[model samples]
Every structure is written in C-alpha cells, then in structure tokens.
Target: MIRHLVLFKLNDGVGRDEPRVIAGAQAFRELDGLVPELEFWECGWNITDRPIAYDFAINSAVADGDALTRYIEHPAHQAAAGQWREFATWVIADYEF
Candidate 1:
C-alpha cells in the first residue's frame, strides 16, 4: 500500500473559523466515501501551537501509485483541493509501507 500524507498551512490572513476555511475542510472530510481510490482517509486540524507545524493534515492510504494518482485526480478531490487553494498551501508525501 502507499501512504499519502498532506500538511496544510493557511494563508497569512486566514483563520480556521473563517467560513471558507471551514467549508474547505468539510469538503475534504467528506471525500472518504466519495473517491473510490481512497482505501483509508484521516484528516484534521493541527493540535500544536508551534511555528513549524502545519495548520491541517491529511493521512491516507491507497493500493499503490496508480491508486494514489486516481485519488488525486478524482473530481471530488480536485474540487476540495480547489477550495483549499484559495486560502491555504499544502505539501504532500507518498511512500510505500
């Protein structure tokens, strides 16, 4: 399986409670059942108050590179990512485990 991890940092002026941020987060939370290539899904806000920590994170797993690609290209995923693009920037990592 491949583990896909994402870490998000909100834009300089954005807040977690802002409607747009809330909605974007909700969109991702809803993707677990919407994308067929997502075999596992977990996401949430960061609990730490450190500068190095990202504001949000997504911890997921898929069958392989192909599955990971499908998950990334899925419409629901694309839409959710688009929402985040307006208020945050993120980094991702994928590895076999």
Candidate 2:
C-alpha cells in the first residue's frame, strides 16, 4: 500500500483562498471516478495552521508503484494537474508504504 500525500501552496492574488481551495478539492474529488488505481481520495484545508501552512492538501491511497503511476499519468488527472500548476507552489511528495 502507498499513501500519496500532497500539499499545495498557492501564489499571491490568485483568488480568495477558501474558494481556490474548494475548487481544488472538487477537482481532486473527480479523480476518484477517473483514475482506476486511485483507491481512495480526500482533500481538505489546513485549518489549525491558518495562514501559515499550505492552503490545502490531498490524501490518496494506492495499491503500489504501478497504481501510483496510473494515477499520475491518467489523462483526466493530467488535465486537472495542469490547471492546478497555474496557481500552486508544487507537488509535495508521493509517500510509498
């Protein structure tokens, strides 16, 4: 199993923080149906850290490296990611377990 956790930091003046984060969460939620190897998917804001930490985060579970690859390479995911890159800092990490 692998827990592919990622955090996204947004650039300044991109948009209102909550709305941008909500849009990202909605976008990530779409991957569940589109990516076969995506066993589980969730997204949320970093409330405790407030304005300090990354704006939002994603939690994904995959079966293995191959599964992770599928999720990363899926066309739907690619499209979603392309849009995210316009506003985000960078992908945090792919945690394999």
Candidate 3:
C-alpha cells in the first residue's frame, strides 16, 4: 500500500478559525467517502502551538501508486485541494508499505 501524508500551513494572515479555513478543513474531512481509491483516511487540524508544526495534516493510504493517482485526480479531492489553495500551502510525502 502507499501511505500518503501531507502537512498544511495556513497562509500568512490567515487564521484557522476563519470560515474559509474551517470549510477547507471540512472538505478534507469529507474525502473518505467521496474517493473510492482511499483504503484509509485520517485528517484534522493540528493542536500543537509550536511554530514548526503545520496547521493541519492528512494521513491516508491506498492500494498502490495507481490508486494514489486516482485519489489525487478524483473530483472531490481536486475541489477540496482547490479550496485549500486559497488559504494554505502544503507538503506531501508518499511511501509504500
């Protein structure tokens, strides 16, 4: 399986409490049911107050690279990512297990 992990940082001047941020987070939270390629899904806001900590994170899994690609290209995933682009920047890493 492929483990896809992402760490997201909100843009400068953007707060996690903002409506758009909240909505963006919600969009991610809803992806599990929307993307059939996902074999596992876990995501949420970060609670740590450390400066190095990202504001949000996604920990997910898929069958393989092809399944991961399908998950990335899924309409729902695209939509959520588009929404997040307005307020955050993210880094991702994918590895096989």
Candidate 4:
C-alpha cells in the first residue's frame, strides 16, 4: 500500500483562488472512479496550526507505488494539477505506505 499526501498553499494573488481551491478539492476527492487503484481520497482546508501545514491539503491511499505514479500521471490528475498552477504557491509531500 501507499499513502500519498500533499499540502498546498494558495497564491492568493488571483481573486478567484478560494473558489479554485474548493473546486480542486472537490475534483480530487472524486477521482476514485477515474483511477482504479485509488483506495481512498480525502481533502480539505487546514484550519489548524502545524509547522509545515498549508491552507489546503489532500491525503490519499493507493495500492502501491505504481498506482501512485499512475494517479500522478493520469489525465484527470493532470487537469486538476494544471489548475493548481494558477492559485497554488507551494506544495509539500510525504509519501509512504
């Protein structure tokens, strides 16, 4: 098994960033159908204080490294990530089983 976790800090330079973040979260949360290896999906805003925490984050579970790679390279993921470029300033990760 593999746990793929990511955190995102919104650029907030664009006026529409909040909505984009919400939409992106919704899209990613619904990716189980698009990627068969996806075991679980969760995303939300960060209202707590953590050393490296971002405004938004996602924690997903996959079958293995290959599934993780497939999830990252999938077209549906590509579209979701492309939207991040406009509103995201930083990303953090911690991937392990």
lDDT of 3 by residue, 1-97 (tens): 9999999999999998899998999999999778999999999888779979998999999999999989999999999999999999999999999
Model 4, global lDDT: 0.75
Q: Could you report the Cα RMSD, in angstroms, for every candidate shown?
A: 0.6, 2.3, 0.6, 2.6
Q: Relative to the true structure, how large is the alpha-carbon lDDT of every model? A: 0.95, 0.77, 0.94, 0.75
lDDT of 2 by residue, 26-59 (tens): 7777887678898888877667666667877888
- In model 3, state the lDDT of residue 35: 91
RMSD of 1: 0.6
Error of 4 at 16 (Å): 7.6
Arrange candidates, best lDDT first.
Answer: 1, 3, 2, 4
* Best by the lDDT measure: 1
Question: What are the models' TM-scores?
Answer: 0.97, 0.81, 0.97, 0.77
> Per-residue alpha-carbon lDDT of model 4 for 7-55, expressed as tens digits?
7876646543468767877777677677777788777778887777677
Give the poorly placed runs of model 1, Cα more than 4 Å off. Answer: none
